[model samples]
Target: MGKFFYARVSSKDQNLARQIEAFKKMGAADEQIVCDKESGKNFNRENYKALKSALGLRAGDVLIVKELDRFGRNKQEILKELEYWKKREIRVMVIDIPTTMIDIPKGQEWIMEMINNILIEVLSSIAEQERDKIRQRQREGIDCMPVKNGKKVSTKTGRPVGRPEIKKPNNWSENYEKWVKGEITAKKAMENCKLKRSSFYKLVNEE
Candidate 1:
């Protein structure tokens, strides 16, 4: 019964003017605009969490975001949220990607739905990469140019100062061969397996 606009910036120092203007152009009232100066890695953001927590988000409520990344970076998480919103009959519109807005052309709902899903998948992956960049800058606490191959180089020393790569744990071949082949990182594999540091290595050594 209501329209909601979500705008996010990774930090307070960033400007929200453009997003605010975009929301107004989309006919969102000033009060309907929800701003979050936080990461899009998850939904733990203050304003975003409050919006989700609020009651009465019934069917037909429209949630608008400036960009797909503004929604979140994780592909699985984004798709899951989209499915949940769809089931509740909520309309999710990503302004930059018109295909994402399914409220148009009821006659071509099927086609639009297909295109929308593809866009969601593609955009979410790109967003995740962008989120990594944001986290990189955040960890450094300053805006530094990222060098070749996603390495953060030192401004003064002119040398790579990236995170130290972890060696593949034992049983990485048996338990998570994907990590060994470099399809995924050891940390990611461990997270996917839900293994604690001790337990994961214990299994590794056991093998």
Candidate 2:
């Protein structure tokens, strides 16, 4: 019965203020604006749900959003919400670059409406698939890169040049002599020796 506009931003770093400003330029009142600041992978949203509950939205009530992806990334969820609006004869306006056109279908115009819905579904599917491909490519790129700031040691290559020397621990005699002579405690001796409790005990048993 009234104009309902919804906007969304994917993260806290993003702002919905621009979207609200645009909607205001279109003559929507402040109270008519609804928003969400979260990922659009799904439609389970507090603000989005409130917008849906205000339904039975007549033929002229319009739904506005910043962009399609702002509405949702999941193809199925996007298609589902759009279809809901279409069925109720509610118009949708997307405020992208040139702003969006709102075309409400009636009578034989339903054919064009059906075609447009089909196009929206096809395009949403392709976008989601392309995003998946790009993410996979980036992950593969990271895994293939060499470990940085570390050595790739080998007998043929020797120690990697300029890398710091890594010390190996001494045997039980040195550790026990240091401890028994009160030069160090058992704990400190074990740590400096870099041996486990069981290994330290084995060394003590040997002497």
What candidate 2 gets wrong by more than 4 Å, as runs, is: 54-60, 96-100, 103-106, 130-207
- The TM-score values for the models, in the order shown, are 0.63, 0.56
Q: Model 1, which residues run further than 4 Å from truth?
A: 134-207
What global local distance difference test value does model 2 have? 0.71
Best by lDDT: 1
RMSD of 2: 13.3
Model 2 residue 32 CA deviation in Å: 1.1
Once model 2 is optimally superposed onto the true structure by TM-score, how far is the C-alpha of residue 69 displaced, in angstroms? 1.1
Writing each residue's lDDT as its tens digit, candidate 2 over 1-207 gives 578778888677887888888888989898888888886778898888877774435676877776677777789888888878878777776665122354434665667666666666776787577657766996775555555446444334454433454333546567678899999998988887887777677667666
TM-score of 1: 0.63
Q: What is the lDDT of residue 33 in candidate 2?
A: 85
